[model samples]
Target: MVRAGFYLLAIMGFSVSGALGADAVERAVASCWACHGAGAAPKDPTMPIIQGQQAAYLEKQLDAFRSGKREDQIMSSMAESIPARENARAAAMIAALAWPKVAGAATAPAPDSAIACQSCHGADFTGGPGPEGVAPRLAGQFAQYLEARMGAFSRGEIASAATMTAMMKALDADERAKLAKYLSGL
Candidate 1:
Protein backbone atom coordinates (compact mmCIF):
# COMPACT_ATOMS: atom_id res chain seq x y z
CA MET A 1 0.00 0.00 0.00
CA VAL A 2 1.39 3.41 1.02
CA ARG A 3 4.51 1.87 2.56
CA ALA A 4 5.28 0.03 -0.64
CA GLY A 5 4.86 3.22 -2.62
CA PHE A 6 7.31 5.02 -0.31
CA TYR A 7 9.87 2.33 -0.91
CA LEU A 8 9.37 2.56 -4.64
CA LEU A 9 9.77 6.32 -4.49
CA ALA A 10 12.93 5.99 -2.44
CA ILE A 11 14.43 3.48 -4.83
CA MET A 12 13.53 5.60 -7.80
CA GLY A 13 14.99 8.64 -6.10
CA PHE A 14 18.25 6.84 -5.57
CA SER A 15 18.39 5.78 -9.20
CA VAL A 16 17.58 9.26 -10.38
CA SER A 17 20.15 10.86 -8.11
CA GLY A 18 22.89 8.58 -9.36
CA ALA A 19 21.89 9.09 -12.93
CA LEU A 20 21.88 12.85 -12.31
CA GLY A 21 25.58 12.76 -11.44
CA ALA A 22 25.65 12.49 -7.66
CA ASP A 23 29.16 11.48 -6.69
CA ALA A 24 29.92 7.92 -5.64
CA VAL A 25 30.54 8.89 -2.02
CA GLU A 26 27.27 10.80 -1.76
CA ARG A 27 25.39 7.92 -3.33
CA ALA A 28 27.02 5.43 -1.01
CA VAL A 29 26.13 7.49 2.05
CA ALA A 30 22.59 8.00 0.83
CA SER A 31 22.20 4.25 0.51
CA CYS A 32 23.41 3.86 4.10
CA TRP A 33 20.67 6.19 5.33
CA ALA A 34 18.11 3.91 3.71
CA CYS A 35 18.85 1.21 6.29
CA HIS A 36 20.80 3.06 8.98
CA GLY A 37 18.23 5.85 9.17
CA ALA A 38 18.92 9.52 8.53
CA GLY A 39 20.49 11.05 11.64
CA ALA A 40 18.50 8.64 13.80
CA ALA A 41 18.37 5.11 15.09
CA PRO A 42 17.57 2.33 12.66
CA LYS A 43 14.14 0.71 12.89
CA ASP A 44 15.60 -2.79 13.07
CA PRO A 45 17.08 -3.75 16.42
CA THR A 46 19.65 -6.02 14.77
CA MET A 47 21.22 -3.20 12.77
CA PRO A 48 24.15 -1.31 14.27
CA ILE A 49 24.14 2.49 14.49
CA ILE A 50 26.92 3.75 12.27
CA GLN A 51 26.39 7.48 12.62
CA GLY A 52 29.11 9.04 14.81
CA GLN A 53 31.09 5.82 14.87
CA GLN A 54 34.87 6.28 14.73
CA ALA A 55 35.92 7.12 11.20
CA ALA A 56 38.89 4.76 11.41
CA TYR A 57 36.68 1.89 12.53
CA LEU A 58 34.14 2.60 9.80
CA GLU A 59 36.88 2.79 7.19
CA LYS A 60 38.35 -0.50 8.36
CA GLN A 61 34.97 -2.21 8.18
CA LEU A 62 34.24 -0.83 4.70
CA ASP A 63 37.56 -2.16 3.52
CA ALA A 64 36.90 -5.51 5.16
CA PHE A 65 33.51 -5.77 3.49
CA ARG A 66 34.95 -4.81 0.13
CA SER A 67 37.83 -7.30 0.46
CA GLY A 68 35.58 -10.22 1.45
CA LYS A 69 37.06 -10.42 4.92
CA ARG A 70 33.60 -9.69 6.31
CA GLU A 71 30.76 -11.84 5.02
CA ASP A 72 27.38 -10.11 4.90
CA GLN A 73 26.04 -10.30 1.36
CA ILE A 74 24.16 -7.00 1.54
CA MET A 75 27.00 -5.13 3.24
CA SER A 76 29.46 -6.55 0.74
CA SER A 77 27.38 -5.06 -2.03
CA MET A 78 26.90 -1.77 -0.18
CA ALA A 79 30.61 -1.48 0.52
CA GLU A 80 31.40 -2.23 -3.09
CA SER A 81 28.94 0.43 -4.22
CA ILE A 82 31.38 3.02 -2.91
CA PRO A 83 34.32 3.43 -5.21
CA ALA A 84 37.38 1.81 -3.62
CA ARG A 85 39.19 5.15 -3.56
CA GLU A 86 36.30 6.84 -1.73
CA ASN A 87 35.99 4.38 1.15
CA ALA A 88 37.69 6.66 3.66
CA ARG A 89 35.74 9.68 2.45
CA ALA A 90 32.46 7.82 2.81
CA ALA A 91 33.40 6.60 6.29
CA ALA A 92 34.32 10.10 7.31
CA MET A 93 31.04 11.44 6.05
CA ILE A 94 29.03 8.86 7.97
CA ALA A 95 31.08 9.43 11.10
CA ALA A 96 30.52 13.16 10.90
CA LEU A 97 26.77 12.75 11.44
CA ALA A 98 25.41 12.85 14.97
CA TRP A 99 24.79 9.61 16.82
CA PRO A 100 21.10 9.10 17.50
CA LYS A 101 19.90 9.45 21.04
CA VAL A 102 17.96 6.24 21.56
CA ALA A 103 16.12 5.61 24.80
CA GLY A 104 15.69 1.98 25.77
CA ALA A 105 15.69 -0.32 28.84
CA ALA A 106 17.27 0.94 32.03
CA THR A 107 20.97 0.54 32.55
CA ALA A 108 22.15 -2.42 34.57
CA PRO A 109 25.23 -2.71 36.74
CA ALA A 110 28.34 -3.48 34.75
CA PRO A 111 29.51 -7.08 34.73
CA ASP A 112 32.97 -7.65 36.24
CA SER A 113 34.32 -8.87 32.91
CA ALA A 114 33.20 -5.61 31.36
CA ILE A 115 36.26 -3.93 32.85
CA ALA A 116 38.49 -5.61 30.29
CA CYS A 117 36.43 -4.03 27.55
CA GLN A 118 36.82 -0.53 29.00
CA SER A 119 40.50 -0.48 28.18
CA CYS A 120 39.53 -0.30 24.55
CA HIS A 121 35.89 0.86 24.45
CA GLY A 122 36.48 3.71 26.92
CA ALA A 123 35.34 3.89 30.54
CA ASP A 124 32.04 5.31 29.32
CA PHE A 125 31.76 2.65 26.63
CA THR A 126 31.75 5.44 24.04
CA GLY A 127 34.84 3.90 22.37
CA GLY A 128 38.42 5.10 22.05
CA PRO A 129 41.85 4.07 20.83
CA GLY A 130 42.89 0.59 21.89
CA PRO A 131 46.09 -1.34 21.57
CA GLU A 132 44.54 -3.19 18.70
CA GLY A 133 43.06 -0.11 16.97
CA VAL A 134 40.02 2.14 17.26
CA ALA A 135 37.27 0.36 19.16
CA PRO A 136 33.72 1.17 18.13
CA ARG A 137 31.33 2.83 20.55
CA LEU A 138 29.19 0.34 22.46
CA ALA A 139 27.14 2.76 24.53
CA GLY A 140 23.61 3.20 23.20
CA GLN A 141 24.09 0.61 20.48
CA PHE A 142 21.33 -1.97 19.98
CA ALA A 143 21.57 -4.99 22.25
CA GLN A 144 20.62 -7.37 19.48
CA TYR A 145 23.39 -6.02 17.24
CA LEU A 146 25.90 -6.13 20.05
CA GLU A 147 24.99 -9.68 21.02
CA ALA A 148 25.05 -10.86 17.42
CA ARG A 149 28.48 -9.32 16.85
CA MET A 150 29.79 -10.87 20.06
CA GLY A 151 28.55 -14.25 18.96
CA ALA A 152 30.11 -13.75 15.56
CA PHE A 153 33.43 -12.89 17.15
CA SER A 154 33.19 -15.89 19.45
CA ARG A 155 32.53 -18.16 16.50
CA GLY A 156 35.44 -16.64 14.55
CA GLU A 157 33.02 -15.44 11.91
CA ILE A 158 34.27 -11.82 12.14
CA ALA A 159 37.88 -11.74 11.07
CA SER A 160 38.80 -8.14 11.84
CA ALA A 161 40.04 -8.58 15.37
CA ALA A 162 41.84 -11.62 16.69
CA THR A 163 41.85 -10.05 20.13
CA MET A 164 38.09 -9.70 20.05
CA THR A 165 37.73 -13.27 18.79
CA ALA A 166 39.87 -14.64 21.61
CA MET A 167 38.10 -12.52 24.19
CA MET A 168 34.62 -13.44 23.03
CA LYS A 169 35.54 -17.11 22.84
CA ALA A 170 36.44 -17.00 26.53
CA LEU A 171 32.96 -15.90 27.55
CA ASP A 172 29.88 -18.08 27.40
CA ALA A 173 26.80 -16.96 25.49
CA ASP A 174 25.09 -15.90 28.70
CA GLU A 175 28.01 -13.67 29.61
CA ARG A 176 27.96 -12.09 26.20
CA ALA A 177 24.23 -11.44 26.50
CA LYS A 178 24.75 -9.81 29.86
CA LEU A 179 27.50 -7.62 28.43
CA ALA A 180 25.38 -6.63 25.44
CA LYS A 181 22.45 -5.75 27.67
CA TYR A 182 24.61 -3.66 29.95
CA LEU A 183 26.27 -1.83 27.08
CA SER A 184 23.07 -1.09 25.18
CA GLY A 185 21.41 0.69 28.07
CA LEU A 186 24.20 3.24 28.39
Candidate 2:
Protein backbone atom coordinates (compact mmCIF):
# COMPACT_ATOMS: atom_id res chain seq x y z
CA MET A 1 0.00 0.00 0.00
CA VAL A 2 2.83 2.41 0.88
CA ARG A 3 4.66 1.62 -2.37
CA ALA A 4 1.46 2.15 -4.38
CA GLY A 5 0.89 5.55 -2.70
CA PHE A 6 4.49 6.57 -3.36
CA TYR A 7 4.20 5.63 -7.04
CA LEU A 8 0.99 7.59 -7.40
CA LEU A 9 2.57 10.65 -5.79
CA ALA A 10 5.58 10.38 -8.08
CA ILE A 11 3.41 10.25 -11.18
CA MET A 12 1.44 13.24 -10.00
CA GLY A 13 4.64 15.17 -9.38
CA PHE A 14 5.91 14.48 -12.88
CA SER A 15 2.61 15.50 -14.43
CA VAL A 16 2.55 18.76 -12.52
CA SER A 17 6.14 19.60 -13.44
CA GLY A 18 5.49 18.88 -17.12
CA ALA A 19 2.47 21.16 -17.13
CA LEU A 20 4.42 23.89 -15.39
CA GLY A 21 7.19 23.60 -17.97
CA ALA A 22 4.70 23.95 -20.78
CA ASP A 23 3.24 27.04 -19.17
CA ALA A 24 6.64 28.59 -18.67
CA VAL A 25 7.57 28.00 -22.30
CA GLU A 26 4.28 29.52 -23.44
CA ARG A 27 4.89 32.60 -21.34
CA ALA A 28 8.43 32.91 -22.63
CA VAL A 29 7.32 32.91 -26.26
CA ALA A 30 4.11 34.92 -25.82
CA SER A 31 5.89 38.28 -26.12
CA CYS A 32 7.44 37.27 -29.44
CA TRP A 33 4.02 37.24 -31.12
CA ALA A 34 3.57 40.90 -30.27
CA CYS A 35 6.38 42.11 -32.49
CA HIS A 36 6.84 38.99 -34.65
CA GLY A 37 3.11 38.78 -35.43
CA ALA A 38 0.62 36.06 -34.50
CA GLY A 39 1.20 33.83 -37.53
CA ALA A 40 2.18 36.10 -40.40
CA ALA A 41 4.70 38.86 -40.99
CA PRO A 42 5.57 41.52 -38.49
CA LYS A 43 3.65 44.82 -38.58
CA ASP A 44 6.90 46.78 -38.80
CA PRO A 45 9.05 46.37 -41.88
CA THR A 46 12.14 46.87 -39.76
CA MET A 47 11.53 43.72 -37.75
CA PRO A 48 13.09 40.60 -39.21
CA ILE A 49 10.84 37.57 -39.53
CA ILE A 50 11.85 34.95 -36.96
CA GLN A 51 9.49 32.16 -37.90
CA GLY A 52 11.19 29.20 -39.60
CA GLN A 53 14.68 30.56 -38.89
CA GLN A 54 17.26 27.94 -37.97
CA ALA A 55 16.76 26.83 -34.37
CA ALA A 56 20.47 26.90 -33.69
CA TYR A 57 20.77 30.41 -35.09
CA LEU A 58 17.81 31.60 -33.09
CA GLU A 59 19.25 30.10 -29.91
CA LYS A 60 22.62 31.70 -30.55
CA GLN A 61 21.04 35.11 -31.06
CA LEU A 62 19.00 34.74 -27.91
CA ASP A 63 22.14 33.95 -25.98
CA ALA A 64 23.94 36.92 -27.53
CA PHE A 65 21.11 39.26 -26.63
CA ARG A 66 21.05 37.98 -23.07
CA SER A 67 24.81 38.38 -22.75
CA GLY A 68 24.85 41.84 -24.35
CA LYS A 69 27.11 40.59 -27.11
CA ARG A 70 24.39 41.74 -29.48
CA GLU A 71 23.19 45.26 -28.89
CA ASP A 72 19.52 46.19 -28.99
CA GLN A 73 17.60 47.72 -26.11
CA ILE A 74 14.35 45.96 -26.89
CA MET A 75 15.94 42.63 -27.72
CA SER A 76 18.09 42.69 -24.64
CA SER A 77 15.08 43.19 -22.41
CA MET A 78 13.00 40.68 -24.32
CA ALA A 79 15.74 38.07 -24.16
CA GLU A 80 15.92 38.57 -20.44
CA SER A 81 12.24 37.74 -20.12
CA ILE A 82 12.93 34.15 -21.29
CA PRO A 83 14.56 32.13 -18.57
CA ALA A 84 17.95 30.85 -19.63
CA ARG A 85 16.84 27.25 -19.17
CA GLU A 86 13.98 27.70 -21.60
CA ASN A 87 15.87 29.53 -24.32
CA ALA A 88 16.45 26.47 -26.48
CA ARG A 89 12.86 25.34 -26.13
CA ALA A 90 11.60 28.77 -27.12
CA ALA A 91 13.89 28.86 -30.16
CA ALA A 92 12.79 25.41 -31.30
CA MET A 93 9.18 26.43 -31.01
CA ILE A 94 9.72 29.50 -33.12
CA ALA A 95 11.75 27.66 -35.70
CA ALA A 96 9.06 25.01 -36.08
CA LEU A 97 6.65 27.68 -37.28
CA ALA A 98 6.20 28.09 -41.02
CA TRP A 99 8.02 30.90 -42.73
CA PRO A 100 5.51 33.60 -43.43
CA LYS A 101 4.97 34.74 -47.01
CA VAL A 102 6.36 38.22 -47.60
CA ALA A 103 5.06 40.50 -50.37
CA GLY A 104 8.02 42.01 -52.20
CA ALA A 105 9.76 42.31 -55.52
CA ALA A 106 10.24 39.11 -57.48
CA THR A 107 13.53 37.26 -57.19
CA ALA A 108 16.35 39.32 -58.68
CA PRO A 109 19.49 38.12 -60.39
CA ALA A 110 22.26 37.44 -57.94
CA PRO A 111 25.10 39.92 -57.85
CA ASP A 112 28.72 38.75 -57.98
CA SER A 113 29.17 39.81 -54.36
CA ALA A 114 26.46 37.37 -53.35
CA ILE A 115 28.80 34.45 -53.96
CA ALA A 116 30.61 35.25 -50.73
CA CYS A 117 27.34 35.25 -48.77
CA GLN A 118 26.39 31.85 -50.16
CA SER A 119 29.44 30.35 -48.46
CA CYS A 120 27.80 30.70 -45.07
CA HIS A 121 24.13 31.39 -45.74
CA GLY A 122 23.65 28.44 -48.13
CA ALA A 123 23.50 28.54 -51.92
CA ASP A 124 19.93 29.86 -51.75
CA PHE A 125 20.36 31.97 -48.57
CA THR A 126 17.84 29.76 -46.82
CA GLY A 127 20.53 29.13 -44.19
CA GLY A 128 22.20 25.89 -43.06
CA PRO A 129 25.33 24.63 -41.35
CA GLY A 130 28.26 26.94 -42.07
CA PRO A 131 31.90 27.49 -41.18
CA GLU A 132 31.02 29.80 -38.33
CA GLY A 133 27.82 28.05 -37.22
CA VAL A 134 24.24 27.73 -38.31
CA ALA A 135 23.45 30.83 -40.34
CA PRO A 136 20.03 32.46 -40.28
CA ARG A 137 17.85 32.36 -43.41
CA LEU A 138 17.96 35.68 -45.24
CA ALA A 139 15.66 34.65 -48.07
CA GLY A 140 12.52 36.81 -48.06
CA GLN A 141 13.67 38.75 -45.01
CA PHE A 142 12.98 42.49 -44.85
CA ALA A 143 15.27 44.55 -47.05
CA GLN A 144 15.24 47.48 -44.70
CA TYR A 145 16.08 45.29 -41.73
CA LEU A 146 18.85 43.50 -43.61
CA GLU A 147 20.38 46.76 -44.79
CA ALA A 148 20.29 48.21 -41.30
CA ARG A 149 21.89 45.08 -39.86
CA MET A 150 24.55 45.05 -42.54
CA GLY A 151 25.34 48.69 -41.85
CA ALA A 152 25.56 47.98 -38.17
CA PHE A 153 28.01 45.14 -38.88
CA SER A 154 30.10 47.41 -41.05
CA ARG A 155 30.25 49.97 -38.25
CA GLY A 156 31.26 47.15 -35.89
CA GLU A 157 28.23 47.86 -33.70
CA ILE A 158 27.35 44.18 -33.43
CA ALA A 159 30.32 42.91 -31.46
CA SER A 160 29.08 39.33 -31.48
CA ALA A 161 29.66 38.77 -35.20
CA ALA A 162 33.33 39.37 -35.91
CA THR A 163 33.29 37.61 -39.29
CA MET A 164 30.22 39.53 -40.41
CA THR A 165 31.81 42.78 -39.28
CA ALA A 166 34.88 42.15 -41.42
CA MET A 167 32.82 41.14 -44.45
CA MET A 168 30.47 44.09 -44.16
CA LYS A 169 33.38 46.47 -43.71
CA ALA A 170 34.81 45.21 -46.99
CA LEU A 171 31.67 46.32 -48.84
CA ASP A 172 30.69 49.94 -49.32
CA ALA A 173 27.24 51.16 -48.30
CA ASP A 174 25.95 50.87 -51.87
CA GLU A 175 27.21 47.31 -52.21
CA ARG A 176 25.60 46.40 -48.93
CA ALA A 177 22.32 47.89 -50.01
CA LYS A 178 22.42 45.97 -53.27
CA LEU A 179 23.13 42.74 -51.45
CA ALA A 180 20.30 43.36 -49.02
CA LYS A 181 17.89 44.09 -51.83
CA TYR A 182 18.86 41.00 -53.74
CA LEU A 183 18.60 38.80 -50.67
CA SER A 184 15.20 40.19 -49.70
CA GLY A 185 13.72 39.37 -53.06
CA LEU A 186 14.69 35.72 -52.91
> lDDT of all predictions, in order shown?
0.88, 0.89
- What is the alpha-carbon lDDT for the whole of candidate 1? 0.88
Residue pairs with backbone atoms closer than 3 Å in model 1 (clashes): none
Per residue, candidate 2 scores C-alpha lDDT tens digits across 34-113 of: 99878888989888899999999999999999998887899999999887788899999999999887865567667789
TM values, all candidates: 0.85, 0.91
Off by over 4 Å in 2: 1-7
Candidate 1: where are CA atoms >4 Å away?
1-22
- Pairs of residues at least 3 apart in sequence or in different chains that clash in candidate 2: none
**Candidates' RMSD to native:** 10.4, 1.8
Model 1, range 1-186, lDDT digits (tens) per residue? Answer: 999999999999999976654476787789888788777899888778999999999999999989988878999999999987888888888888898977555687788899999888999988878998999999989989999999999999877778999999999999999999999899
